[model samples]
Target: MYNSIKEIVTAANETGKTIAELTIEQECQLSGKSRDEIWQRMTVNLQTMQAAVQRGESGRGVFSQTHLTGGEAVKIKNYRASHHPLSGDVMMAAVQGAIATNEVNAAMGVVCATPTAGSSGTLPGILFMLKERLSLTKKQMIDFLFTAGGVGLVIANHAGIAGATGGCQAEVGSASAMGAAAAVEAANGTPEQSAQAMSIAISNLLGLVCDPIAGLVEIPCVKRNAIGAGNALIAADMALAGCTSKIPTDECIMAMDKVGRGLPASLRETGIGGLAGTPTGQAIKARIFGNEV
Candidate 1:
């Protein structure tokens, strides 16, 4: 029912409710399902996300068929366990969680795509990090997902969440923006702050192309999720620190949409441009498909 970020915030303020609560209410109306039903469904998604993160951090991650992305999450986890990461534990943990989720995705493992499978890592990265840092209960974690959903809905409506239609900016960018706003709400920031977090997150990665090397969601896609998690954290922190986005979230999303559209067709998940166009990229494609590409 919420068409824009501002509208959702206004509704939340007027009703003295959370963006998560409003999102649940709207889903009830749109899907004609009871609140309990919707909550149960979301609970499953939350559980799935948690499971994927845990699997990735298990020190023996699953590898994709192409062996392109696999155990990097475990490597991150181990590295942080033994060494002082320059980015600190929180950021590294987010990176670990984000990479783990996407690695699992590349392996064809189950994951709850916040908006899309190609960009599944961002929300869980921040959400789980907050879960441990803030000691979030299961219900609270689910609320975080709903808050993310509210922001993602606005972006999907105005711009899109498909890499094919809007490039990696729409997939990873929107997911990161969703995570930023949701992280803000989970940290008890105001709805307006959540909107600001979303704006900053979207603008930070606008026009990111969706060039999966060798047409696989490995190479850059998996690493991009790690960066998306970092972006979400930075944006959320900025909003919580009383920072405001000069461009409203709705405008930021629109701007992202225009930029994604302006990108050449080669950049929009076609797997034939960007890194995919490089000589090494061509060699990988040839190795994978044997002249088929």
Candidate 2:
């Protein structure tokens, strides 16, 4: 199996296989499962994501116990219905889907964590929206996830994936990169273009910290996922348009790991710095926990 982003790209180039095909082959080898079985599971993941989006847009059971994240998806939908959106359908849908998935996670509902729950929203948000925007078939949508998973596998093995270990740069940044790679492939770009998309995406989010208010993945995490989805879309479009990253994809992932390691602990999901340390953030924590700020 390909271990690094470079290797993944090399294998795809050598075999003349799509990123999705390489990833699916690796998954089959790793899991000892048939291709049909793996495909079926990914289909279930897509269905779950679609359901969370629907629930989020419906504005039902969207609130958490702390009420930190909820109803934002519905608000976006309502705004779109009334006013002409400047961002257009795909972006608007991506934002809505991202927020919806995170809101579901916050509400303790079911969600398919593309890599991790805190960063889960990016993939589904863009994937489902692109399904309509690009007129992709179900098979193509599943292929998108596999392509993204290839990137994630490389990052997780080479650098890291958890915010606790590598800060939000590892979590949301990796997820955004993965989504961007997948989007490039889904749009019929080559494996090399997908890797470039991932590089561009992660490079832009290099130092993002993982500061959750009250240690809850609600405050900035939810909104950050929305932005991550947007970043993925932009990066994918850039790559498809023949834009390239000066830094290679593997080097970008390594840089993200280094940045995360250099970050202070307060910024790594500690809830003691960044936006979580703001006066309003402290007050919200106090209000939620019944403690003085």
Candidate 3:
């Protein structure tokens, strides 16, 4: 039997675990300890990446950016000036780096089928960025993660997480929903508000598709994460303010599933439609594949 979004969130609260951790625990219970073991390995991988970043050893691939803080106007100017040439703020940069460069650092084990490697940066990135801003303790961070996990598990059970299977709703949509729920929890929103945030996220990203270029997760994938993160913030705020969507979270997830199912194969992760069909995408493919297709 499929678990509803509310049910999942309730379970998460009861277990005192994040959605990701709960997912691992459930996997372990059903499939042995393999998933849990893999999660531990991924944790080590993330630590190594963070260390490399601290050492300035890893080159910023697609969207690398210099860190900045302070005066709003100055920060705005800096953001605009450094926006070009890509920066670390872009979700695509991280995702592309993860997939094309095999430089994953962990968030939800997107390298596996459940999450795409390219879209893997959003959840972890948002959480890390929040932690940096709030100076949250490790325990707090874990708690936030557990809250987010409950929302994610609901989406997985009600909708999906595979772009190939559910288009961008599964990829960016799910990520945004997870981020929104996480943000709400981090902000101390009630469980009901967290679920509302997820609903808002799904409603906003209803028909998004998976259209990577040259079969690569770059292009729209990375930029989409930044947008998704922003959306998550918006949704969380709205939910926290006591705004409720006409459609419930579970209904929204179901709608997303229906929309994804209706998408043509070309728009589905086959890299045959949307931005993937653009001239730039074709040229990149030519350069990379040498007309092999």
Leading candidate by lDDT? 1
Best-to-worst order by TM-score is 1, 2, 3
TM-score, model 3 to reference: 0.73
Query: How much lDDT does each candidate structure score?
Result: 0.92, 0.89, 0.63
True lDDT of residue 258, candidate 2? 87
Q: Over 4 Å off in model 3, which ranges?
A: 9-114
Judged by lDDT relative to the true structure, which candidate is superior, 2 or 3? 2
Q: Please identify model 2 stretches exceeding 4 Å from their true place.
A: 59-61
For model 3 the local lDDT of residue 142 reads: 61
Per-residue lDDT over 1-293 for candidate 1, one digit per residue giving the tens place of the 0 to 100 score: 78898899999899999999999999999999999999999999998998999998885887899997899898888889899999999899999999999999999999998899989998899988999999999999999999999779889999999888899999999999999999999999999999999999999999999998888999799999988999999999999999998998999999999998999989999998999899999899899989966
**How many backbone collisions does model 2 have?**
0
**How far off is residue 76 in model 3, in Å?**
10
The TM-scores, one per candidate, come to 0.98, 0.96, 0.73
**Candidate 1 lDDT (Cα, 0 to 1):** 0.92
- The candidate, 1 or 2, that scores higher on lDDT is 1
- Each model's total of backbone clashes: 0, 0, 10
lDDT of candidate 2 over 99-147, digit per residue (tens): 9889999888899987999988888899989988889999899889899
Q: What root-mean-square deviation over C-alphas does model 3 reach?
A: 6.9
Model 3: how far is 13 from its true place, Å? Answer: 8.2
Per-residue error at 1 for model 1, in Å? 1.2
